[model samples]
Target: MAHHIWRRSLAVAAGTAALTVGAATAASAHHCYKVDWNPNAYANHMSGNTAWMPLSSMGAMIISAPAPDGAGLPQCASYASVAVDHWMAETGATSEPLIHSRATVGSGAAYQGKTVKPFAYLQDSDYAILEEGLGMAIDQCMADQGA
Candidate 1:
């Protein structure tokens, strides 16, 4: 009777340990695929804008942004050019991603009755760099307009 009770207790303990390990594994797996967004970054940018969300843990969206205006496609292209230049200057050639700009005419919240030339950074390290680069580009544009 004593031997049987001991065996039963051992079996229960083993089952509890297995369950605990499984639960821990599942939690870690879930954490890896979670999508996090930075509200501060979202608030600072304009209407037609996308970038790596600030303060994210792992994984980032393919960097992309819609052009500013529909009628002025060249203006949008120029803006992307300037932004890329600023980004390159800040991050250098080795760290900077391949910048691509393309114009697309569409009607939506971000692009309503305008041609938006989207800018994409192929390989960027973090949101901070992208945000700074974007801010610099926009500032340059503003300065040009002011001049």
Candidate 2:
């Protein structure tokens, strides 16, 4: 009985290890594919008129679009988070993920004395910040283009 129990335990451990390795392999195999978007849909500058903006991440290049009126920063963050959640949903890039999202935005740190609001949601109770640099880059792009 003891030997039988040991064999069963070993089998279970082996099974768990195999499942973990398979999941990791699948995830690593995931790659970004081609996508299409209207170039005009993205904002060229920051304005009272909200618009979609792009953010870069490790998994993909994402976008942050304006939140509905009264949705505030949380909504903007959601826009970014969702884009990263699915990656290709908001990007036009055809290559593997590139760019490290980074920037200093409104009431945040200093980036050439420009601080724009972050467009992507980087932090939440359920997950750590995705690519903060992407958030910053989005804000800076808005500011630079607006200027």
Candidate 3:
């Protein structure tokens, strides 16, 4: 079974509680696809913006949450997570149905004097797609950072 992050640091909770996820260890990713790319997004720059990311794990990926106010974000809060999950399922990541029936303003992390909220509900069923999304976002960040 793939191990995903059952719990992670929610830096964007504004001192709120961090999030808790449930998944297998086989698919546990140390570096979240979306978070890895946008380190300073939630706290410093885009607090309420969402970012799509590609991942190192094949077609897997991630999506960032909406940036907060006064973060000078690039993207706005949208249902990007749903789209990304669909993309992952299309590519054969997992069969778990994408459940966007509820609107979730999930938690974030505090990195680099900034708070970043994570958007995508990355799970085993959708790991591939989110990871791929993380990869995409990371690629974008690399270009932006000239890395």
Best by TM-score, which number?
Answer: 1
- Candidates' lDDT values, in order? 0.32, 0.30, 0.31
Local accuracy of candidate 2 as per-residue lDDT tens digits, 12-83: 333223323322332222221112333342322112133222332221212222122111222223334332
Over all chains combined, what TM-score does candidate 3 have?
Answer: 0.24
- Where does model 3 exceed 4 Å of error? 1-123
Instruction: Assess every candidate by TM-score.
Output: 0.28, 0.21, 0.24
lDDT of 2 at 30: 25
Tens digit per residue, CA lDDT, model 3, 11-39: 21211110112112223332233333334
What C-alpha root-mean-square deviation, in Å, does candidate 1 show against the real structure? 23.4
For candidate 2, the lDDT comes to 0.30
Clash-forming residue pairs, model 2: 45-146, 77-121, 101-133, 101-134, 102-133, 102-134, 103-136
Q: Which window of ten consecutive residues has the lowest lDDT sum in model 2? A: 62-71
Q: Model 1, which residues run further than 4 Å from truth? A: 1-77, 94-96, 99-125
lDDT of 1 by residue, 1-147 (tens): 676555444433332232233223322322111122245544443223543222111111111211121112223224444434554566554222321122221224223534333422222243344344444443444455542
